[model samples]
Target: MASLVKKTKKPALQPLSFHSHPTMPPPPQTTLSTVLHLVLFLLLSSTTTAISTSQDTSDLEQDCTNKWIHIRDLPPQFNLDLLKNCSEYPLFDNFCSYLSNHGLGQKTYNDSHSWYRTDPFMLELIFHRRMLEYPCLTSDPNLANAIYLPYYAGLDSLKYLFGPAVNSSFLHGLDLFHYLAHQDSESIWHKNFGHDHFLVMARPAWDFCQPLSNDPPIFGTSLLELPEFYNVTMLTFEARAFPWQEIAIPYPTSFHPSNLALFEAWINRLRRTRRSTLMLFAAGGGISANPNVRRSIRLECDNSTNVSLNGSITMKYAKLCEFVDCSNGICEHDPIRFMKPMLQASFCLQPPGDTPTRRSTFDGILAGCIPVFFEELSAKKQYKWHLPEEKYEEFSVFIPKEEVVFKGLKILDVLMSIPRAEVRRMREKVLEMIPRVMYRKHGSSLGLRSKKDAFDIAIDGTLQRIKSRLEDSA
Candidate 1:
């Protein structure tokens, strides 16, 4: 039993196997340096991966910043569904069918975007079609910088208000709400609450904001007020203040030239012509909420009637809606005569309609006539996105609405006081501005193929705004 075994010497430390127990202890001191080296190697790899990821994200953002817009491929039903009943409204009944001709109605072959007045409701169609024809549109979401939501929210709501449905605004609104809410979980709008998304409409913002019980039934819904729409930007015909979510866009007009050459030719012809009238007031200021403002305008115009200013610009007046037949939601006057007043007048009166904005302002601009605004709300703050940032006095005349109303200030005198040379300069400015305000019959109206026109400017301006907002958030 005492014949026993021999003992061998053992080292104090040894390399540890990674395949040790779950709560493995530290490696032996002899292997500690190796463990530290391994840790450093892994850390470098992770850091490299992270830097690469950051670079990729930055590249994507920069690319988007340069004019990449992703259009949501919405279900066809969303666009075409309401279009079935589109013509139910009197003003826009023919517009839905005229999309093929660029909303030119039956006058598509008129060799120019003239003759027939373009219905204002053509906006929803125009903006949607513009995106389809734009250079910045991207089908791939990953490559997109901003998202476009082509909901036709204006036309969709207006049909109910102006159609036989009567107060059925909620019908389409509820449907739209559910449609947005039930989108695929991966939808960008679903997660971001549509912050990067935008929709353009021809209607005012008031139509989308739901009214109170005592509020006038404008046939609207709570779509804009809903929590889902808080982050989305709105391009509207007339954007009111307070929420500051909406921006004003110009109303649709009849002069949608196919090419810049043609547009320039038309403008040059107008510039060459002489304006015989100092100011022309075609609309009646007969009766409104504030009757005095309009009545005074009527009285001033009447007093100045048939009187030539400085023996060059005569003052003329007419009541458009009453004398002109606009029964079909468009005036049926001879195209030549209709535009004559605007074209002959050096400055055309642009008073407020139901809203602060008026299509007449744009009409006068297209006619190569400077706009004369009585209400600041009419054009001053309404078109900040589209107009030049120049002072109002440069392109328009602002005879204080109250001054003209109560004090009986002479509009003719105020206009005559400005030098005739200055008036010529103002007219030239309006001629240059024609392209910016007009929606072309074709996207390539200017010299460049697919040159940006009104539609392009509006969309691009909105995208720039969206980028700024995102940066602020970050």
Candidate 2:
């Protein structure tokens, strides 16, 4: 089957407190008799009006504060059937394995606290499970502030991506929209024409967008172009600059902590780990549509050391760099292998792969290795809701791709030039960003110490965006 499996594009690379005040007493009954009675009635009427207004305001505040998410009861075909029939498809030959543990993949090892072999393609499942555990989920659609479409769009696209029929690529998505359009007039999609509804697309947005004539014809579907989905928000791993409907989210990493304590412990481990190597690059170079960047990085790795054809850097000739050569495509499926190298390195090289983004970027952050970006869209242009745009330099370094790939600039020189104190500061900022870039276990509870993780940030951002969109239209 030509190993239809994609060579893992290894990267290179607040609580509200309510206070109530007691109502003031009405003026004492003055002894004007009839005048007094009339004045008393007026005062009481005004007081009642004030009380009613206050109650309405309180109700409004409560509603505004609670972010209610309603999951649609989509037909099993849109979600469950995809899983049930996963084993039948050659494209999904190993897909069923990733469905374990609520789509967080298998555990890295027995008794491992916060690690998983998460597949980047399994995001919709993780998100669906997390949405199920959402604190403010509502059973009634009318009561929901945001609607969640529980369709496994990512999984559903596999057949199209791998099938021989290019023209049939969009049929399933078309059927999905048709199904949605046929729903009752009062259904969620009909309400605002799905403006407030959102779906998680584990793949990049381009997979669902219309492909250009010169582009690879078998790459994607026309789902993104369908009018039925125009207003629907898409939470994807990568998003385009236009179509503000798509929001880029952090790619799922190997770390899925069970609670806040474990999350904190992981950060602490990253802080205390001793990094001996100046930089690490763990990604595949054999199979990628976009190989120029990795080729440049691999060339640097090879020329710097007596690298074997396998691309491994033997310590005999190794100096400032370490390469976990993934040319065979192993690290893409098992990211844990990259962990040891990343933990021992001060910086993780994150060059764009098949797309502008790489799963290794999140993995690098998780390991507390400051990321070095060769492309602006790789990190700076995405994840606005999770990563602070103003704080990129605090945690990451940017060296333009042209400098290294075309100009032959040494990545080591730029990194070594950074002061140790500044490096430490950057590492600290990277650690601070750990929680925001990960998706904690769906049901994980951290009590009073709980911080907002990726899932929380995504839902909040979606709701806020939907609210603004609704208001603008209103």
Candidate 3:
């Protein structure tokens, strides 16, 4: 018992206080929760940046792959949504519906109010009337006239066929008004009438302020008192004196060299004026020995103060087909010689002769070249496949006067400045439009598709402009 008590007493004083230790250091202020939060934040930021980079790469690749994005490629639902933004016009809806229902071959009747009517003469008359009273008739009278004559004649025929009792006076009145409205102040009708009355009479069918009146009014005071007439007017470009002063007259008899002269003059002019960037002309025969006009053209070009002609000149006019010389239409059928050169050119200058609208320009457009146009001798005739002004702005070019001196900019230089790839794309777009802008007379598929025509392109452009103008006005 004594030994056990002594062992317990010795254990109490065994450990002494040890304050300063060399082996251990102090702990840091950072907690485990704070360290975990910083790591998670860095991981989320990195993941988000990687995802954004991957999306950007994907978008860039898609844009590079799809070159020609057509309007049709848009989703049907998206297209419908866009239509909702359009004006609610019953005329447009009905027109689109008619187009959809007719498909292209639908029989066009004289009685049909629709644009697809086969009897274009009466429609031509209506168009001419509209032109007289509007600003739309300034540029191409042949086109205006061509559209109206056939349509009006058909309308007159339809009236006679439907009702024998219908008086010819109605037609006479319509015709007379059109003639008087277009007449000059020196003409018989304008000379006798007072100005105010004449204007009033003309007001029903023609634009008052239009500057193109061939004849100015002799009397202004008494013309405004006339009663309004309800007669339906005809649309047609009237035959008249040539508008532009004669710059140069090619030897009309010599087809080849004279044609070449015209082509060279146009090219030189376009070169002088940078407005027109590209030009092409193809003839059906070799250059004539009698290069009278050609010599003149060369002299003018050499003396040209504005443009210094530096580009290489290649004469492709000799390579075209001479269907005009062929008696049996055999040369016309030879597609290889006739169409190939035109296909190569950027524009085909069309001059009127054989068929009304079948100029070299027609052949060129058929071969995928844009038609550079001048008003024809037959002012009122319309080319069935003529591209409108706006479309022509994108696809074609026009020279108004005969003298190339007015145009002093270099078209070739401007075109050359454009990237080759862009020019190639524009050429392709023109080629694609050919089928829709050309017509084939042979019933054979030698040219563009028969269903499509030049007027279609023009009308489509006109309607679009009208709609746009209306929207802008609104």
Candidate 4:
């Protein structure tokens, strides 16, 4: 009976409700608890969604841009106050003005009657000499100091008080003109003998025999002997002559088979001794024209000194891409590749090799790279003649050779901390200056054409120095 009854156990009695029993009013709610749970769930879900959205946006933005694009968008930092807006300076205008003003520029070549009358090259020498004397003309104090004191007063006097002395010194110091004459031995010997006989005869007696022990010859035999005699005589005397002066004027005494090497050695010595000066050696054809020069520059930059040599002043050479080669005819290599990286980098090392002024600095500026300069060695000094100490505060970073290693390390650290976007903007600013700052002597003439010359822009900061110096002296 028990087994038969257990097989049919009644299902648990369904709760009898008259109208679904009011659906068992959900378990009595704790208002606070319920509200808290709902809020927590919502916050968790929202946070997850927000994180996903942020990450997606970041990825998208990153995917759309690169370092170059950002750099290209930045603004330029060079001071343009001095430059005439990408146009060449009016040499003719300056010359005309000088002529009208009865300045040294008015002097004509070889009047034959006037003592001041001389070769055309002498005029250029005089002009350069005069330019170096006036503090106003020379933007930097160092350059002014480099000008010989005697040359300074003579050239700056407006009357060219030392023109005769300059001409005489040039004639005697440089030998190429006489060598080029190729006169008959009689004429050559007689002419030269008459003019230089005192020097020639005095040299052997003074140097070799030491005839006058009290006031021995001030210079060596090499200084007194003619070029033809240099090979013939064994006097072995070192000439104490300004290499540049000799090259500029040309004379028998100045002619040396090793003149080129001597000039290079002199330049090297100047660069080495004057650590404050930034040297720029520019050459065409990607520095292949003179690898030795390039090597020398590299040695100077990398090993000799750590002073703030402009990146453009380095002996290190980089082949620029074709796109940035403004010198369409002169620059044969592709400029874009070189420029692209330079624009990206903070410094563009430019060491001139063969060209008058290192073109690399302009390339660096075009690429938006700040030039690291050795002020004195760069031929650009012949034009701008001063370091833009203030204006360059924003765009360029200068370092003396002694501080290069330390300063370079510091700069790297600073650069790393800067945001990528900001760095790009800075570079872009530099690149933007190409049209305004760079000048192609042949393409756009010389100097700047628009408002001011590149020299003005470059020396804007130095102008402040002039003002300050003037004020201080006042």
Candidate 5:
């Protein structure tokens, strides 16, 4: 056995075989150089891929930036003149004051409040101002992908809407149509019969759609009824259900943040707010034609004049409800008086006002209060461009007006039945939607290119829609 044994000398270093060994010692210099080269190759490849990915992202952002739009230099009567002589409107006592602060109305909140007496119908002025400052605006129409008509159609309709010359409601709209007809044949108007063009309406679609049966002309015009306007896309506060060129936009709220920091601060304040009341109803009882709806809601919240003001709880299950009784219609434009109750309540009542749509729907969102809508058209059917249609329950509750008015189902009982954890989640969702519905102050030098507010969303959607149509036609 001793004679058969053979011994070999151990080398200074053993050769590393990556293929053979699960674990191997460090390689020699030559092999180490190869390994380094492999690593360097991988790193370079990875860097190339990274650069490519960055370039892709940058290209996407550039594409968005390149989605240029042109604003038709409309006559002053269309926009500027309307604002200059806003005094003539006489819709409000100080109608001209609403034109100040970029059409946000006089500052009701001087410093920290950031609120104004914004008229619900003042969106035309607000939108025009925002479009003027749009970053991608091109003066050359040939280079434009979409055209904006800054016509004060809403303001223009006011004179004819409520006036005696109801038959002449289509005068200004016809003037606009004639103005477009006179444009060069090669112009954008003729390119797609104004299909690539869009305008923002400060009123509901019904106000512009005057039917032949509309006797006494109860505040409506034939503007939308114009055949020439069929192709033009309209961004309205309240759009018709279907087959109309109207798209519903968020109603202008009193809280318009000047900058992103201010916006974030407001959001944080809402998140940290201590809600003391179970629910809030801050509108005028006189606003709704169906008196029973408001009466039922008021009675359920123990806010009816007899029960709330007299300090008598007639109901067995009366809850601490906040009411901003704008019985005289004073709180309609004043946000400071109305939003406080919303901030202190878990839910804000958004029953149908003069129309099914109310400015309070968006205001409740701004205050981070979950909205309690009584009508489908109130919030769910509208705001498809801004609100999550599928996730309505995430941020809102729907109680049919028929149930409350006829069946006598209690709103407080329904809202109180939801677990507190669910309420917190809903509130968070509501807070998350504040920015989308809010029309933040435009032309801020604060580099808010990334933060798309209501204006941004509407414009982007409009441009995209036009682009898709143009592409399909091409």
Candidate 6:
């Protein structure tokens, strides 16, 4: 898969405090595009050898048909059956919804020229479909580098997690383990003890960890807890510290560029667009028991709004009590209503939600907005595969939640104190990250000038990890 790159053991990050150093001197001023150019130059140089001008599906298919990765074509019970009914996908008696525009959902927003608001939970469907378009896909296991288990484990487990009748009896989880147990030396599981195998899930690590642990006893399953999964890689939205490595991936956003032109247009637009709002927080509050600092930050944003600053600090959809229905990858496909605020904001406040990590972090970064993080684990501790091995302040703004709640620190002033040049530099860094953090719809070909995107990085990193692990064992 790859030669050698350290894939295990990520060093802990020193917590960054975005101090309101009013007298802080600005670093050397660099144009936003210059930073972009430097970053792209480094990346392009590294990947120039692998970047092909025309990697059409036909060539990739022919090349990989018997020499890349083999996909296990499971029965309807594994994948197809889950998608047969959109309503029952998350639950048996769920909402009846139709998927238009090839599972991206019908574009309800008027602004088709710029961006569209797509559902967040459709990642499982999107990824599974996109996997078919992967150049490394092969039907024959005989000529394969690794094996892909295209199981809708996240979708399948969602039923048990959100169902009305909950129990520890996860039939789907048990059934999968039983199937794996029956594998012989000819099976992919027998190939290096399933070290070269992987499966992608749209949900976080907690969804699968939960085994009806709540006092009221919400539905939870024990799928990942099974001993059989210890050797296999689990690709999830938020990677957990399990026996085997769990890879973190960006949540599926509305913007899935079909071509390089569209991708370039989006990045250029973000670079030139004038951000009217100083900071915006689009997260919901009062969703959990403690609700943590969300409620506090929401109040602060509400109190600090001003017309003169052109909506300096804004908060939207703060409480998500009614948002439980869409928790299982079944959200309204359109997200532009929420995305507009992100597009207009200079900095987006991203606090720790149910977990330290939030999908909105990627959304804010993709929208070219500098993110303000409260916790180290949100992006710093997590996303080792996607984020750089450097301090969090390089691409994001970090202020401890205590300062906003008790220390009486003004987030707006703190962020505004940052030099304009530094802000542009950070925003440019965020824009430069678009290609790496986003998942392009790589149908048939990786498209023209396909700069290494989130999909490319994730796959390449996982492959190298496997190779490194196998070699160490050897």
On TM-score, the candidate that comes out on top is: 2
C-alpha-based local distance difference test score of model 4: 0.28
lDDT of 5 by residue, 1-474 (tens): 000001123111221011122143321112333334433443353334324433335545586464777777666566655554454445533356466555776655333334566787788878876765565665567767888888888877767854445467756488788777785555568878887899988989988888645556556887887888887889998987774688888998877666555566567667777787778888877334554788887676664323332222223224456777877766665555666667778888989867899888888888888999998898788888799699898899999999999998878768767777999999999988887898877555464456778998998788887887777767
Candidate 3 lDDT over residue span 268-370, tens digit each:
3222322122344333321335423222233332343344443432232222211123234332323333343443454454433332233344345444555
- Which digits, one per residue and each the tens of the lDDT, describe model 2 over residues 328-434? 55676555567767888889999887788988899899888999999888878888999978999899999998988678788877887787789999999998898
Sort by TM-score, top down from the best: 2, 5, 1, 6, 3, 4
Summed over model 2, clashes come to: 5
Model 3: worst 10 consecutive residues (lDDT sum): 245-254
Alpha carbon lDDT of residue 336, candidate 5?
53
lDDT order, best first, reads 2, 5, 1, 6, 3, 4
- What are the lDDT scores of the predictions, listed in order? 0.61, 0.72, 0.29, 0.28, 0.70, 0.60
Per-candidate alpha-carbon RMSD to the true structure = 26.5, 17.7, 33.8, 36.0, 21.8, 14.2
TM-score of each: 0.77, 0.81, 0.30, 0.26, 0.80, 0.75
Per-residue alpha-carbon lDDT of candidate 4 for residues 1-474, written as tens digits (9 for 90 to 100): 000001112111111011112232322212333334433443353334324433324554453221100000001111111111111223211122121101122211111111111112112222222222222322221222111111111112111112222222312322322432353233433332221111111111112221123233332222223443331111111112222111111101100111223222322322222121222223333424343334433434344333443454344323211122233322212232243344334455543333323445655564345565544334223322222324454555444332433333332223234444554465555544443343211112222233232323423323333334334434
Model 4 error, position 224 (Å): 21
- The parts of candidate 4 lying over 4 Å away from their true place are 1-169, 172-346, 350-357, 374-387, 405-422, 428-436, 440-451, 455-474
Q: Mark the regions of model 3 whose C-alpha exceeds 4 Å error after superposition.
A: 1-338, 350-358, 373-388, 398-403, 406-419, 440-474
Candidate 1 per-residue lDDT, tens place, 1-474, comes to 010011113111211011112243321221334333433443353334324433345555564455777666566455544455544567534344343343443341222233333567657766765566555555555556688876777766765666664555545456655666686556676655666778876688777776434244565665666666677888888887665578888987766656555555566668676676667765544444565555665666666645543333332223211122223333421233335567767877776655778777887788888888887778788788678556567788887777877776877778778777898888888877777787876445337345556787887788788888778766
Q: For candidate 1, what is the TM-score?
A: 0.77
